[model samples]
Target: MFNYLKELSFTRGAWLLLTTSCVALEATALYFQHGMGLNPCVMCIYERLALLAILVAGMIGFLAPRFILTRWIALLLGSYGAVKGLTLAIKHTDYQLNPAPWNQCSPFVEFPETLPLNVWFPSIFEASGNCGKIVWQFWGLSMPQWLIAIFAVYTVLFACLVLSQFKRSSGMRERNLFS
Candidate 1:
């Protein structure tokens, strides 16, 4: 199992698969949330943004074989996912504030309520949505918990892949110098 994870981290196709799975999962969650009457909380949207970043990075990595750039982008995305997961976990577990900060409450793209430009940034990061509620649970874990697990795994995998690529590039450089 450990060896397989290492391999997946170094392969672009694997990265793409990881990203695609994340996108699909988010879509499924969204479908369940909107179609099934489960409104999302602020933490959920943060997770979505993190997943979006990874999805975009994976698409670019797949399309481009330039490992250095692709790996860097993936690392950035993975870092974002890690932070998002940590934030979600904290908000869901420790802080049980109902109706997250208004900005965190609404979708970033959809601003039902207008705020002054100076206050907009805080709204963007503050926790204010319904997604934080533990409406859906399995084995005592909530939706955000599941999301955090997935994103955390992805982040670790992405980091491993970046390291693997760096090692491979270093090896190639050494070989070229000796030749």
Candidate 2:
């Protein structure tokens, strides 16, 4: 059942999955921001950056050989990125569930001069709208809740990958020693 973990370790498909997922996430975010006229908050922007980092690391990892140390490094970094995103998602979900006394309730969102993501990519990274506004909901859950669910899945997958690699590599070493 889990044999694919060892087999796929040498293939690019594994990293491709992460890369593809991140791209889809970014695309959906862009659609919401540009087409639906819903803007993201500061924390949401940070989440997007984390997702982008995962995407980039996944791409680089896919290009490396499976046994190479670089792939492990990339995987670790990607896992960290996913963890960062999940943390933000949890915070956002909490804020949505319980409205806090914060400046995020403003009618408009403004990016600090230090963070020029809006200026660099207005279409994707702009923060022109408030994050406190519960504008959209699907299946009775808000967007941040959905983001949390997505990140949870990624975290589990990464954990499984890590475990599978460790077990399989140790087994391989034992077989080599016996032979």
Candidate 3:
């Protein structure tokens, strides 16, 4: 199973699946924001950015999955994005579950000066909703809660891919040493 996973990581289909899944998630987020009339908060915006990172990683991997350099880059980016997104989602969930005057999220969204996402794309990146407000829920889970699960899955998959690479490399070294 581990060998299969290692081999799969070098295939285009795996990378395509990763890219397509991220695209679907992004589209769903936009739909929730516009079509469903759900406003995003600052935390949500940060999560979106993290998702974008994963998407870019997937694209890079898909471009050259067989290349070790590209695979490593993709793995690093995906791992970073997954961890960041998971952290943001947990914080967002905390804000919603334990609301207080001093423990609430800020009203304004602050992106880096070099990348003013809100200024460039107000409709998508602008954060006008309060983080403590539970505007939407499904199956008894809030948006942030759902996001936690999503990010967790992404993180686990990335970890597995990384492990597979290490295992494959070690196995190759062992074989070379014996020969």
Which candidate achieves the best lDDT against the true structure? 3
Higher-scoring candidate on lDDT, 2 or 3: 3
Q: Which residue pairs clash within candidate 1?
A: 9-161, 40-131, 41-129, 41-130, 41-131, 42-129, 100-127, 100-128, 101-127, 101-128
Instruction: Write down the RMSD of candidate 2 (Cα, Å).
Output: 4.6
Sort the candidates on TM-score, descending order.
3, 2, 1
- Residue-wise C-alpha lDDT for candidate 1, range 1-179, written one tens digit per residue: 44454445456787678668867976786686657766656656556667777777677656543455555666676666666666665565443434445423333334346643224654333434554356777888777667667766776766665556544333232212123
Query: Which prediction has more favorable lDDT, 1 or 2?
Result: 2
TM-score of each model, paired residue for residue: 0.66, 0.81, 0.92
Root-mean-square deviation of Cα positions for candidate 1 versus the true structure, in angstroms: 6.7
Who is ahead in TM-score, 2 or 3? 3
Residues 1-179, model 3: lDDT tens digits = 66777788888899999999999999999999999999999999999999999999999989878777888899999999999999999999999999889888888998899999899999999998889999999999999999999999999999989988876443332222123
lDDT (Cα, tens digit) per residue for candidate 2, span 27-61: 99878877887877766777788788888878887
In candidate 1, position 103 carries an lDDT of 24
Pairs that collide in candidate 3 are none
